[model samples]
Target chain A: MSHTYRYPRPALTVDIVVFGLDAEDLQVLLIERDGKPFRGQWALPGGFVDVGESPDDAARRELEEETGLSEIFLEQLYTFGNPGRDPREHVVTIAHYALVNLNEHDVKASSDARNAAWFSINDLPKLAFDHSEILKVALDRLRAKVRYQPIGFELLPKKFTLRQLQHLYELILDRELDKRNFRKKVLATEIVKETNQFEKDVAHRAARLYRFDQRKYDRMTKQGFNFEV
Target chain B: MSHTYRYPRPALTVDIVVFGLDAEDLQVLLIERDGKPFRGQWALPGGFVDVGESPDDAARRELEEETGLSEIFLEQLYTFGNPGRDPREHVVTIAHYALVNLNEHDVKASSDARNAAWFSINDLPKLAFDHSEILKVALDRLRAKVRYQPIGFELLPKKFTLRQLQHLYELILDRELDKRNFRKKVLATEIVKETNQFEKDVAHRAARLYRFDQRKYDRMTKQGFNFEV
Candidate 1:
């Protein structure tokens, strides 16, 4: 008996939503495409996945290649595969979200990409492909994850003030969190450790700095303690 | 200038991990294929998705066709797109898990499927394709989900005893939960309403039955009540 098998192949790409906090505003990194399909159009930093790398690795590599940033907290958000999403061809993109501290990287925006820049998430321009939808999904996941996990620290600097932490929560949750209530809840979780330091240069009084105590959090978590803020 | 357009497309398929919980053990539904690629071998219910239907809807339709069961709680777990996952083609499958009450459906083992049957999760045979890995991922998700959410109820009857509920939790968590603590946690959440019904025709002391109060749970959930069992 002879059998014929038809190979089914799909073009796979990875799109990353790199989020950063900049001066009380939530921002996302985007790139202007330098190639075809959407030349010169603004889009998420992404590209086709290579042969052997996993989708997560592809997302990280694309982000690094375009922005020179890595070692950040990244997660797989979703896979966007609507056949009509890409007008030029059938591209399936695995969307990922990366949280980075803006202060750590100066963002050499004109490297591999036509132009890389940070845009306030609220003030995003019309993006190429289905990036708008992908951004929305990433934001939703970020909000949900922030509520249940300690991932919000990823968007903050290594050492931050309680006010900054509260602001980050307010930005993600899109609401005004009472300073007293926010600090009370966050400190009660015991995930933050007070540092013997303060902000270097600021107009107002420099509040005491704190760092995410991952070791203590991990130990407590293994002992069946829940983290909520 | 002449323009060449590259159409981007991803090969899409739907895979379902149908889980059933008999009184004693957790089982997954598998089918014997009558076609090539894995002809005559047992596999998970799946097929290439058709145009005009969402991958989620395609998964549901495939489950119904291959298992003759519908109206079950189905959730999109993850998309599996490892390059070598499918030997016959470069296929990316959107894997889903469906929880059905075993008592509700008859064992129509050969309805639309060549040969379909439920196998205990522990003693599953060498499955066709990458189904074994898919099954493992689904089970991991189920185990994690059962801890913080009330989805385990989907595998139970509408009216269930406290003991049955406890057994389901133990089976999913693979650990024994103290009965008193379990009852206190579940009852304190107020998601289960006592039905004033008792088990009939039992050899031992009959236990009172209860039903999940989804409406109350929904309202309480909106009010930020966390349900953990």
Candidate 2:
């Protein structure tokens, strides 16, 4: 406690809300603390920010370390800086959120000496610290942002059918959308390319697959495209 | 130099990107530094975060202390925590941005012994530190947000003409919007209420004035209304 600054300094940490689209709803990644400070309670997959690393870097590293998930895109959500957010001391956590395809990564509870698991966002367990508040904010941003941004696609596989895409939107937006209108409006944006492939290993008829057209979306965005659903 | 901790703590600061609409273009509030570390240079109005205050409170206090403005909407934009961002030391800043109506506040350059000024977003002078990058991010967010959010009204007066609303959109969006289409789309949202009033002190035929109905907007938003341009 011998810091000589004009005022006391707060310990900084990073927390991430990783959302994945399950078959029926959205889910988030959580880690069961192996030790004290909310021990055995599930919390966001994050840790302290090392001395020289940026908060972003710390978030990415922590995501990989605790969840065994890497190479996913994450965006800064918000910073939670209440003086007593962390019971251990005066710690501030920069919260980040990311969308991921669950099929791509297999999550294990015991990785890197940490226990990780996936919990349905709507029915989450008792979270540690102020993590529940962080998750709520992340969900609100995901709901609002997917309307204009193409981030929802991150939760789906590269090749997906119109049904899967519609289901993804329905789960996040929490509204039943008309299938015809959803198809018409999405196609009008010209942001999706109809692939010749079809869904594999389905009990019913396999619907045609479509891929989000990154190049077309980028060009249209530059030309002032207003993406609304 | 006397801090005693398991890890080195980075100094924390708060920086604000204060935006305003000044009739012709979007503008930002900047302070001309009066002391060293960029003395006499233009920078965002901000300072170090006191230990006990949250970042949001720090931003509000700094905005008022340095610019003589308060009680406005300020949202946390992003946190910049890369090493070497501040030359003086290892400092991380939580960046915030706010929308203000220029008519309501009188900006002073020498308020509280600080030199504060508003510069047009496009014609801003070279700024001190990494403030230029911060300003660019804020402008992009503003342009993107105005299309879906009713925040553009923050830049306009309580009662404004449809022509004034259209002009504000064009200036922020940097596009030539068709008047007929703009009015039809905006009216369909039902967020604006037409007042039995007209613009005064204008040369041409006065246009009907309108006010954004906050209560209506809040209700519509609760029902999942999508506001898109």
lDDT of 2 by residue, B67-97 (tens): 8888887888989999878887778889999
Evaluate model 1: give its lDDT: 0.81
Q: How many angstroms is residue B82 displaced in model 1 relative to the true structure, after the best TM-score fit?
A: 3.1
Chain B TM-score of predicted candidate 2 relative to the true chain B: 0.92
TM-score of each: 0.79, 0.88
Relative to the true structure, how large is the alpha-carbon lDDT of every model?
A: 0.81, 0.84
> Lowest summed-lDDT stretch of 10 residues in model 1 chain B?
B1-10
A44-107: candidate 1 lDDT, tens digit per residue: 9988876555677788888888888888888888777776888765566778899999998767
A69 in model 2: Cα distance from truth in Å?
1.0
Write one digit per residue (lDDT tens) for candidate 1, span B100-163: 8898866584358378989998788888888999899899889867765678888889999999
For residues A1-229, what per-residue lDDT tens digits would candidate 2 score against the true structure? 3345556788888999999888977899888887788899999988888767889999999898888788887988999998778777777888999888988867763368876777887789999999999999999998877766677888888888888999999999888999998899889888899989987898999899999899976775455444456
lDDT of 1 at A114: 63
Give candidate 1's TM-score: 0.79
Look at candidate 1 and give me any clashing residue pairs: A89-B7, A89-B8, A90-B8, A90-B9, A91-B8, A91-B9
DockQ of 2: 0.43
